[model samples]
Target: MLRPILFIFVLFFFKYTYGQNEIYELRVYEMEFFKPANILHDYFEKALIPALNREGVNNVGAFEESGETLPKKIYLLISYQNMQAHQDVTDALKNDTQFKLDAQTYWETPSEKTPFKRIESIFIRSVSGFPNLDKPADDSEFFELRIYESHNEDALRRKVKMFNDSEFAIFNDVGLNTVFFGENISGNQMPCLTYLLAFKNKEEHEKAWSKFGPHPEWQRIVKLEEYKNAMNDISRIFLKPLTYSQL
Candidate 1:
């Protein structure tokens, strides 16, 4: 009888732990044309990513903007099981011997001569509707990172509710392949939410979005009074995965 009770407790603990929402750190490296990004790429491909994997983080995505633009930027997505897990990884990296050795080159570089001018990190937490980052099964060539900024906290809450209550289902029906959805807990834009979508190509992206606006369910819910003014601004960026990117 004691053994059975212990087994039940273990089972319950496993379910609760695995069902918890995730935390994500989106790091953006802003680079100037004068500096080459090879060192930065090398550190990620050779040192940082591998170190994170050893520490039990998986599916780390490294990407660059799809088109050439001034001040080129690289995007890195790192997911943690939870806030505590994220803190643990951070503390562990400091004492990771192999990680230090591999990152020696980057560490030795002069600040003024480094590959990137600055780094911006955005912290996010998974929403109820999307509790984990979903790696695409298909070979996705194009990616979209979108952010919706709300006018206030209440508006942001409503927008998140719309996603949980209806928008996510509509996205599935319209063929919008989502990678993740989270609310920004700490970042440049307050009261904002961010999400990523993957597609086979630009044509597929256009096709999928074309279906979303006219979908009957979307048309109906979008007009609901509760959701009005839920978002005041939207920002989007197109990205392509680097050769070593896991996502």
Candidate 2:
């Protein structure tokens, strides 16, 4: 009888621990030019990503601007099982011996040889409606990162409500492959939210947006009084994943 009771407790404990939503950290490395891109590439591909994987983090994505955008930037998207996992993985990586050795060259570079001008990090909590980051299918080659800024806190809440109440479902029906939707809890941007979407290529991206515009559900929601003008500004960047990107 005691054995059966203990087994049941173990089952409940595992379920409770593994069933929680995820958190995400998006890191942007800004470079003046391509001079340091090689070093940045080596660090991410050879050291950082592998270290994170050893800590049980997966689906890490490394990307760069697709076109001739000035002031080249690299984006890294990392997902954690929970907020605590984020902290734990970060702490674990710092002490990883192999990672330290692999990243030595990049770290020991002279001040003048730094790889990036500055790095920006954003911490976000996944929206309740889409609480886990989805890994794109192998064929996905393009990712669109979008930031929606609102006029105020109320406006941001309404915009997020729009997504939770109806927008995400519409996206699925319209063939948009959404990876994650996160509210920026702490970041350079205030009163904003960011999301990532994947596509097969440029053509697929254009086609998806075309379909989304006229979708009946979206048409109806756009006319809703509460959601009107919820977004005040928008910024978009197109990215292509690195060859070693896990996403």
Best by lDDT: 1
**lDDT score for residue 180 of model 2:** 89
Which 10-residue window of candidate 2 scores lowest in summed lDDT? Answer: 32-41
Q: lDDT tens string, model 1, 13-132?
A: 887688678999999999977887889999999999999999999999999999987789999999999888999999999999999999999999898779898899999999999889
The candidate scoring highest on TM-score is 1
- Candidate 1 Cα misplacement greater than 4 A, ranges: 1-16
For each candidate, the alpha-carbon lDDT, in order, equals: 0.93, 0.90
Model 2 regions lying over 4 Å from their true place: 1-20
| Whole-model lDDT, model 1 | 0.93
Taking every candidate in turn, the Cα RMSD to the unseen true structure, in Å, is: 1.9, 2.5
User: Candidate 2 on 52-166: residue-level lDDT in tens?
Assistant: 9999999999999999897888899999888888988889988999999999988988877776899998988888888889888899999999999998899999999999999
Alpha carbon deviation, residue 158, candidate 1 (Å): 0.4
| CA shift of 108, model 1, Å | 0.6
